[model samples]
Every structure is written in structure tokens, then in C-alpha cells.
Target: MRMRITRRGGLVGLAAVAALLVGASPASAAPGDASAYAAKIQVTLLGQPAVTAGPFAEAKADGPTANSLATVHLPGILDTGVLNASASRDDQTGAVQSKASTADVRLTVLGALGAEGAGTRQGVGNNTVGAQLIEAECHATQQGVAGSTKLVGVDLGSLGSVDATPAANTTIQVSALGVDVARIVFNEQIHNADGSLTVNAVHVTLLGGVLGSIGSGDVILSSATCGPAGLPIPMASGAGLWLGLGLLGIAAAPAAVVINRRRRPASALAAEAD
Candidate 1:
């Protein structure tokens, strides 16, 4: 005799298939064990030079600033994770000089799973990392305009390599009569299941000079990454279901904006100097 499958049975089978396709297995699909697992986090920064100064000289600058904090509670791999990355530049012109600074902070629970029990393990900590670039220019109508650019960035994963040549391109310009300035800063932190946390911070700066007009100077770049090692933990199936749903909410969140303001006029600079 032939057997018939019910609609409910078919729906259950289809759900199982969909979960497997996304790397979720019966063990992994269920909540994870936080006590025995650890996570890997990375961050990067990049900057570009494209500023000009003269009869209508102009300067532009931009850079990345990212911060994240998370609590883990399961035994699973959180590898190949990049928490934050950004790049920006500032462009201006005339006899005017300008300075501005802004900061952003975001707190998120990447994922959490596992049940409460005598065998459950718990911990708390933080990790931080960063990168930066600075460039400036000077000009002199008498002596032809001249300029120089430099890049100094730190890697969160390896503090020893902080002073090395940055993986990104950096440029600076200067004139005999003019002056330019630039600065970059980055910071980060992470918490793992082993009850431990690590923090990393990096800052970069650039300076140059020449004839003086400082006709115009442009460009800056930087990047960084960090990772920590620790044990794994257990997670309950119910927890896994909710964590998965939470990820969907994060994916649908709105994106942040990057501002690029117009250069100030020479008259504005003179008034500020006064």
C-alpha cells in the first residue's frame, strides 16, 4: 500500500533543509555552550588625499571611527568577524584654518546562547584596537610651492607592528608660506567566554613644510585588526532560536551618514585669526 505525507510533516522537513543550508546543524542549530568557545574580531581604517589650495584652494578630510561590545555565552566559533571599518578626509583653502572632532559608540549583543547549570562557565572583559594618518602642506609665492605626506598606523592584533609602513597610501603637501595639519585616532574592545577581555588603541599623525603659499595639500589612509583566544561554552536550543532572530533585526537596521563640508573662505580665516 502507498503512504501519504501530511502537510505538517512536509513543513517540518522543509524547515530542517533550510537550516542545514545555512550551516545550522542539530547541535549547532540548538543554542550554543558559552563556557568553551571564543571569538575573533577585526577592524580597519582607510583615508584618501584630494585637497587643493590657491586662488580658490580647497582641502577635504575623512576617516573611520568604530566601537563595539558583546557578551558571548556558548561553545562555537566566531571566526572571520570584522567589527568596524571606516575612512574620511578634510579639505579646506584660503588663509583660514579649521578644526573639528566627533565620536560614535555602539553596543550590540552579537549572539548569546546556552543554559544555566552547575557546569556553566561565565566571564566578562573588553578588547580595543585602532589606526590613523595625518598630512599637511605649506606654500610661498616667492619660492615655488612644496609639500610632504606621511602615514603612521597601529594594528590591533600585533602592537609590535604599530610603527611599520601602513598598508594604505598616505600623502602630504606644503608651501614656503602656507601650513597644513591632520590627525587620526581609533579604539576598540572585546569580551570572551573565558571571563577575559582585551583592548587595543592606535593614533597616527603627519606634518610637512615648504615655500609657504601652502597652495594646497591632500590625502591620508589607515587600517587595523584584532583577535583574542579563549575556551568554549554550552548553549540551549531555545537560546539559539532567539539569537538567530536577533541577527535579522541587526541586519535590517539603518546605516550611518558620512559628512563632507565645504572649505572655508580666506576672509573667514582672517576673522578667526583676529
Candidate 2:
């Protein structure tokens, strides 16, 4: 048995599909900044800022550009060389990617000088981190997101020990006099409530009052954030709008033609047939 679909019914179905294309786009729905930072350091005394290094190597999708910085030092506290950050976005596809990197990092602390005479050193030869978000338009999770971090010659030193390749969000802390003194987190990743993603290659913080208003600092390295945004929405002007209009017209064409032909007189149809 053969089943025939009426022209009106097919047209209605096509119209519905066009409506979906114009009204909804799941992959590129979220909105947020795609950004990255290479490194920074801040020290506070009793919660007041004292020394600062940089939030320098930074990138953002506002301009969809990359940036870098070279050789930063704060004697006895921080030293680093060669930092880079970059971000890119496809406006038509609504895809974004971000990255950050750093080399020759060393953070030192003297218990006597600031740790109240406790010696500690945090070190790393080089590191890189990256994140990407693509629209889930065509495939299910494939090419949708990519994230990773790499580190070489890491010396946790007194900051706390860890495997060369630490797991995500690996943490270490130092305490004294039954109070927390310092903390470090490695390879951290977070998912925002707004459906965005953030990655931090390293984070360090030192609380004040280790030896009466002595040590206080906060630092971050190789950080990136990106929107889980997806494919472009079609409701706006240009190609998307034209595409929608074209689909609607095609769908309505058969139905309109069938209705008009049915209303014409049988003699007119016979004359055409003759």
C-alpha cells in the first residue's frame, strides 16, 4: 500500500522546521568572555596590599587577540621569564579558544625574612594551559570542547610535594602555630553556573601574621576561561534570516499552488490539458 502526504500537511511540516531553525540554536546559546592570563603575584600585610608583580600576559575575545610579556621580577619574592596568553573566536560559528603559558618561575620565601625564618621555594621550569569550546551543532560532544595543561621541572619544594604530573585541583598547604600559613592549588578546573568553563594551571596564596604581620601573598599562573557557546543563532539578519525565509517559501509553495489550482474552473484545466 502506498501512502500519500497532502500538500498542505507537508507544507505545515516544513513551516514548523523553519520556525525551529529561526527560533532556536542550542550550541551557541551561552554568553561570556573567552579570556586568558599568564601570571600575577600580590602580597598583602594584614590584608593590605604591599608588593605586586603582574596580571600582565593577558588575552580576550573582545579583540580576539594574543599578548605576551617578558622577564618579571620582585626580588626575594618572585621571578619569572617569558609569559604568553591568547584567545580566539569565530563570530559566525560562535566558537572560542583560550591559552596561557609561562617559563622559568621561582617564588621564594625566607622564614627569617618574611616566613619568620622558615625557608621555602616554589619553582617551575615551564608550563602551558589551553581550553576550547565549539558548538555542539553537528556531533555529540565530538570537537565540542578541548582542555589540558603541561608542566616541566616542577619543584614543589617547601610549598608541598606532588607527583610530576599532578592530578586536577591538586592542593598543598603549610601551617604554623595551629593556623594556616600558605596554600597552593594546581591544575584547577571549574564550571560556572552560566555554563562557562575556567582552568587554572597554578594558584598560590600566603596568609599574613605568620610571625606578626610578615607574610601575605596571592598568585596565579596560566589561567583561562571560555564560554560553552555553540553555533550561531539564525534569528538575526543576513544569511540566517534569508535562509529562514527561503525555507518557509519553499514549504508554502506546494500548498499554495495546490489550493489555487483546485479553485480554478475545470474548463480552464481542460483547455490547458488540450
Candidate 3:
């Protein structure tokens, strides 16, 4: 006898297997800065795909520590969203201080065929999804220290589905001591299934004048599906099904063989009695 599986049943089974393989962790707050007069930021996801939506934000600062200036959450089948932070600190002599800001902060999710599959094929629908930080600024001033850094035309990170070509671009600029240190830009041309794509840019400016010095920088971080909260396993057709079951120690062949052997033994015993 042959066994048949429905699409919905198969998906549920696959999801269960994925949960067992990847496990699940409760969401927690983002960590604080390691040093005084420093700024820190983080993103977290709440639940698994097709179940919960998230990518929450928790930001903090010290020594003129900044507050969560603004935050946006775009939860979906998978957790996704962004956070921003801004703060300023100054010294008694006014010779030392720091000001910083982060924007377009977000998390992303993408789907791809499992390694066991033959040709490469992305998941259907919106396989690429993420948030962005339109801009960020960090400025520091110190006396007697003269240094500069710059980043321009560099790829910070990418968002959107693998099935569609990205149609967005991102760029960054950093400067110090009256000189351009870096000018970086990242351009993407992937097509989006929903025909929606956006660009993000971060600009940093640092100045060290006469006996004073300054520093500034920006960054774009990303993960496979969820954010720092943890890696949430994603589901797709073809290889995804087998991969999930295999990881859970329930390979199709062994299970099928066990069932067949059990049925054969019962039938053989009945025939011998007759």
C-alpha cells in the first residue's frame, strides 16, 4: 500500500520537525554598553515563521546614554522590524564629548533550497524581507589625538527575497580631521515579488580641530531569517521537507521500512495458523 500526504499535513509535519531540530528560545532584552560614555543597540525576534511576527527593538546608552529615539515593528509570518537610538555626552572642560544616532535598523528573512536538493531554487512568494536604517551618525571629540576614518560606496547589507532581484541601494560616508576617510555605497538590483524595494544610507562626520580630535562610524548588521533573538528555521518545497525530517532522526526510508515489516509479520503469522 502507498501512503499519501496532503500539502497542509506535510507543511505541519515539516514545521514540527523544524521546531525539534532548531529548538526555541524565549525573547529577551538587548544588552547594554560594555563601557561608560558608550552607545549600544540590538534587535530581537519573538517567534517562529508562519506563527509569530516580531523583530523588536531594545536600545540603551551610558554616560549621556541615549534613549530609544524611535522604533518600528513590522511583524509578519516571521518576526521583522527596526530600532533607532540617539544620545550625547560632554565633559566638564567641554574638550571631550560624544553624540550618536542610528536609523533604519531592522531584521530580515530569506528562503532557499536545502543542501540536499539538486538545482538551486528559492522559496515561493516573498523569500526576501528585512528592515533598514536610513542613516546613523557618531561623533567623538578629544584633545591631542589626531586620527581619521572614512567608508564610501560599500555594501552594508542586503534585504528582499532571493526569488526576486533586489532593486535598492545603500551607502555610507565617514570623515575625520578635516579629511575624507571613507566613502562606501552598496547597490542591489534584485527583483522583488511584491515590487517593493527601498534604499538606506548612513552618513558619519568627524572633525578634529587644532588641539581637539573626533571619531565617527556606521554599520549594517543582518541574519538569515530572524534577528539577534536567534535563528528561526524556515520552510520551503523539495529539499526542505526531507531536511527537516532527517534532522529529527525520522528519515522517510527507515519509517516506511518499519511500517512495512510490521504489517508483513502480522500477515505471515495469520497465514501460518490457517
Evaluate all candidate structures by whole-model CA lDDT and list the values in order.
0.23, 0.60, 0.28
The parts of candidate 3 lying over 4 Å away from their true place are 1-65, 69-71, 74-84, 95-137, 142-274
Report the alpha-carbon TM-score of model 2 versus the true structure: 0.63
Say which prediction, candidate 1 or candidate 3, comes out ahead on lDDT.
3
lDDT of 3 by residue, 102-214 (tens): 33332222111110111121321233222322332222232221111122222222221221112233433323233443332332222223321112222212222321122
Report the C-alpha lDDT of model 2 over 95-192, residue by residue, as the tens digit.
Answer: 77788877776655323123322333332322211111100000112145545556766654444455544576778765555566766677776777
Compare the candidates by TM-score and give the number of the best one. 2
RMSD after CA superposition, every candidate: 34.1, 9.3, 24.5
lDDT of 3 at 102: 32
Ordered by lDDT, highest first, the candidates read 2, 3, 1
Candidate 1 lDDT over residue span 1-274, tens digit each: 0012233334444554444334333331211111101122221112322222111111121212222223222122111122222212111111111111111211111111111111111121122122232222222121222222232332232112323322222221211122332222322223445322222222222232232111112211111221111112232346555555454443233111111112556687588779
**How many Å off is the CA of 153 in candidate 2?**
0.6
Question: After superposition, which runs of candidate 2 have C-alpha atoms over 4 Å from their true positions?
Answer: 1-32, 46-49, 109-146, 158-160, 176-179, 209-213, 233-274
Best of the candidates, lDDT: 2
